[model samples]
Target: MAERILIVDDEPGILHALQRLLRHGLSAPDGSRYQVDECANGALALEQARRHVYALAISDYRMPEMNGVDFLTALRTLQPDCERIILSGYADLNALVRAVNEAGIARFIAKPWADFELLSAVRQVLQVRDLVIENRRLADLVRLQQGQISAQEAELRRLERLEPGITHVNWADDGSFILEDPGDVKL
Candidate 1:
């Protein structure tokens, strides 16, 4: 499935603008582009997040219903894998810090943001998110392989108990099998 991004702003124009910037600018190394979804406010954005898993969410800091930080925090519980960013015109340092420490936002973009900067932030965050998800997938694969190995080993022990002192066979990856010992048979 194509990766998706969520953009939220109280102003309709801002929402539309951010969506356009991301849809055209954010490109992955494989030439993949983002599927952009826009919301007019934080509350509706939260609902969208619940319905779909987004790769990233970019939200304006101030909104009539819920603020950007709160929206991100709630999203963390539902889709903790999603990356987050906040856009703000205000210089409220404390709130900004709270957004970082509390909401675990990936980055912040200022209002009237530079097109290049916003695009760069989106690319970077999505790259990191892809890496994290890939790492987890690989880890799970390793765990499954290990479990199979352990089960095979256990079965081998059980077979040995049933036929004590029987000659064991080993198989090579190239599809050749041989008995470890061929006792005293001269033919």
Candidate 2:
């Protein structure tokens, strides 16, 4: 499946350009294309986020109602795993710091961005996101397997308690079960 990306910019032109750039330039690590969704304001973006899962969110720092930090911060609460990038023309250090600290943005790109740089940022962020997701999946699998093993062990112990030595078997050199007494078996 194509990974979904959310783009939030109040300016229509910037939103269109970003959508075009991402659609044309970026692909998931597996080579599947991205599904890009755009919103002209933070409220609209948040509304969209509630409806669908997003792999990443790219937001312009300056907006009408909610700034990039606020939007991304709110997004973090809704979708904690969604990666974020903030774009801005103004280099307000405090805002950037808040973006990094509060929003946990993955990257910050200055406005009038180079196509390659933007593409690279998206690529790298997606790569890292994929890795983190895969790691969580693997961790869950391991946990599930461990639980299965524990259950199996408990069953074995219970069987052993019910019938002592029931869980143990003697093997013959010829890969057959070694009977305690040969004459005890019937044809």
Candidate 3:
């Protein structure tokens, strides 16, 4: 399945341009991947994001409705795993800092960004998201294995109690099996 990306920019030109550029630039190793969606405002972006699972969201900072920071904060509430990027013409230091701290932006693409850089940023953030999901999966696997191990240990202990005096059988040191019954076995 192709990863989905949602671009939210109040500028119609930037929204469509990014949609076109990203749709063409992003491709899987087999040259087939990605579904890009564009929205003109944060309200529509939020609604669309709720309906679809977006791998990454690139939003412009200054918007008429909700700004990028507010939109991102809202998005995080709905889709905590989706990666976020902020794009802005105004590189205001305060705005950037607020976006980073409040919105949890993965990347900040300045206006008039190089195509390669933009693609690279998106790729890097997606890679990071993949790693995070994989880590969580591995941790769950480990937890499951630990639970199984504990159950097996408990079963072994139970069996040991049920079969008391059954451990004295002597087998040849070399590869061989020897069975000796408890002389007066009781249940």
Q: In order, what lDDT does every prediction score? A: 0.78, 0.85, 0.80
Q: In candidate 1, what are the lDDT values of residues 139-172, reduced to their tens digit?
A: 6556558784464555554444333223255679
lDDT of 3 at 177: 67
TM-score of each: 0.76, 0.77, 0.76
Best by lDDT: 2
Query: 1 or 3: which has the higher TM-score?
Result: 3
User: Candidate 1 clashing pairs?
Assistant: none
Cα deviation of 73, candidate 2, in Å: 0.5
Candidate 3 lDDT, 1-187, residue by residue in tens: 6768999998889988898888888875456778999999888888776567787899999999689999998888667778999999988999999988988999899999999999999889988987886675566557567784464555444343333323335678895867644332221
Error of 2 at 41 (Å): 0.4
Stretches off by above 4 angstroms in model 1 are: 148-187
Error of 2 at 172 (Å): 64
